[model samples]
Target: MSSKQPDTGRLTEPCEGYLVTPPLLEAASFADRLDHALTVLPVAAVRLRLAETSPETMKRTILDIREIMDRHDAALMLDGFPELVRQTGCDGAHVEAEDVAAARKILGDDFQLGAACGFSRDLAMLAGEKGADYVAFGPFGAEPETEGLALLTWWREMMELPVVAAYSPASEMADLPLPEMLHTLAATADFLALGVTQDGHSFDALWQTPEKFLPLFAETAKD
Candidate 1:
């Protein structure tokens, strides 16, 4: 692995927060809830993971959510639709590891292109070399793998390409408090990709008060 960090440098906070949309959400209703949730939390971005729907419906959903994201200055990244990014006026797209180069080409140099790299550092580096804006690392879940955490630490120390530490909390841990879950994740990642909805707890309910989790973002800068 290349030890040279990129010119971009590390963020002051240990991790920045990002949200993953529920696998299925009604765009119109979800937009209102999303808008309200964002108004309170300081999320860096949101990945729209709408279910496979008609192209027109998908476009409309993206448009509706895009408007709210725009207002809050949070990036709206299409889950796996690089082709629809420009048409829907989205900030960027998140593509599978093998499709990183294609997505980058389609979105060009301006849009944010992210790669889902799982636990493969080789794949992560490959995506970065291919012009990915960021690389996502694994389904770390509640019981994170030691190797995964080590890799994340190494990447943070060696690379400036941002990483989103993806997690799919185990179903058994569904009732765990969101703040607690987030704190556990912050230890190993700079951004958290939460796709699983724990017991139908809305983001609003999980992050009901800023005081509960905002301090995690206010710690002294990491060396």
Candidate 2:
């Protein structure tokens, strides 16, 4: 190895955390992806974005996936769809800054609650203090429209709470492989919501599998 230390960026851990994605496809395709995922990786958890697809269809898909895959830990994220989340009987729900209190009240303490806080450290901290199970930030990539790396760095430096950053596969400039991305995430965020965008749309694409997360696991295991 070179005398120089890897740029761990002040992060220290074996790099294992939750991986979440949306199954916004036909029920058959979604079930196939979930089966493949359970077989491949140590999936810490599975998340479904309810609002991306038709609510009725998504509910059916979520239940079916849960029934078919017995190994993977399952959680549901309701992005601006509280009623649907409640009705689906999900393990938990994800809410925006505005809906945190209400979601917490409804979902109660036992349920996992995740909040989205664009680039605000204060919001992230607040989410933690308000009893959020986790906090999410960027769809971290080369989109100038999205929060840049600096914001994520600031949040990491200031907060003790687990931070989740979204990974955008569509960004033209995000050339770093999954291992490199996981290294960066270890240094900055606690969990990563690898956003698999194929046509400039969220969740309207094929779900990338655990093979995608292998580089990250390998890199983190290194000396």
- The Cα local distance difference test for each model comes to 0.71, 0.57
Displacement of residue 170 (Cα, Å) in model 2 is 3.0
For 1-223, candidate 1 gives per-residue lDDT tens digits of 0112344445344566677777544577676657755665556788888777788888888888877887885788888989899898888899888899888888887788889898999999999999888899877766647888888878876788878887665553434355454566676567766545444334443333433445545552222
The residue ranges of model 1 lying beyond 4 angstroms of the native Cα positions read 1-12, 172-181, 195-215, 218-223
Candidate 1, overall lDDT?
Answer: 0.71
Determine which window of 10 residues in candidate 1 has minimal summed lDDT: 1-10
What lDDT does model 2 reach?
Answer: 0.57
**Model 1's TM-score against the true structure:** 0.82
